[model samples]
Target: MFPTLHIAEKTTGSRGSLALLRWALVVIFLWFGCMKFTSYEAMGIAPLMQNSPIMSWIPAVFGVQGASYFIGTAELVTAAALIIGTFNKMASAFGATMSCLVYAVTLTFFLSTPGVAEPTAGGFPAISAGTGQFLLKDLVLLAASACLLLASIRPADA
Candidate 1:
């Protein structure tokens, strides 16, 4: 479990940790987005994209490979915005919104992607250890993105 945050303390550790989280998200987005430029990444996501009603138009508009590039570009740009947000409030707001959008969109794949859930001895909502785990992990990213968004959108103290 993570340590409890004391907002009133305004400790160096707290601010540093928050900053580090932002940097980590930026790096992860950049790395994953870069992978989309490759054939393997494109192919790997083909089924998920095809199955997703929201994303079905991607292949028609950008083609399978091109869609990957488009997503990759989005990722890189979002990462850049987050990096800029480190210094500017407007930039942080933009980056935070973008990051949150990305997380929300991807999280929807829980509905579109098959094998995400499997029949288990327990019940109807059992999650697959593989694909299910992968999609569920995005919750943390969503929370982190939300944190950034809240920090950026709130009015500065007088």
Candidate 2:
């Protein structure tokens, strides 16, 4: 149970937390985007992505680099919009759509790949069970994004 605090509606704490979350999301997006650009070769995900039937159209246009750039730009723009707080609703909506797309692509890849196990580090077994696990996690993230988008659009009167 949480402690009850009869605080004023105008308290800075709630607003500050919201700001923190916004910035945190921005940092996460920037980090992932940078990773996609910088570590393309080592990641080995590009081939899987290219082979994915769901992403077949992606390789035709930008190839791996172009796809990476496009995804990176989306993340960067979403982060910027959220941080600026000028277009929070639109940004969140876009982010939710992006998350859903990612989830779908990853899920399709997992389903197509057989015996695709996560790589082990040192002597320890990998944490993820493979693409299926990745899909499951991404789905949860998609749900979270959807919730954020919904909350952004919710009517105050309701």
TM-score of every candidate relative to the true structure: 0.87, 0.63
lDDT of 1 by residue, 20-68 (tens): 8799999999999999999999998888788888887997799999999
Q: Give the per-residue Cα lDDT of candidate 1 at 52.
A: 84
Give the per-residue lDDT of model 2 (tens digit) for 1-158.
99898857442234355445455556766777666675553245676666677766765787777777766676666666555542556665566456456555666775555444455643223434655465557555555454445555656454
Give the poorly placed runs of model 2, Cα more than 4 Å off: 1-24, 39-43, 85-87, 116-130
Residue clash pairs of candidate 2: none
lDDT of 2: 0.58
- Candidate 1 matches the true fold with a TM-score of 0.87
lDDT of each: 0.86, 0.58
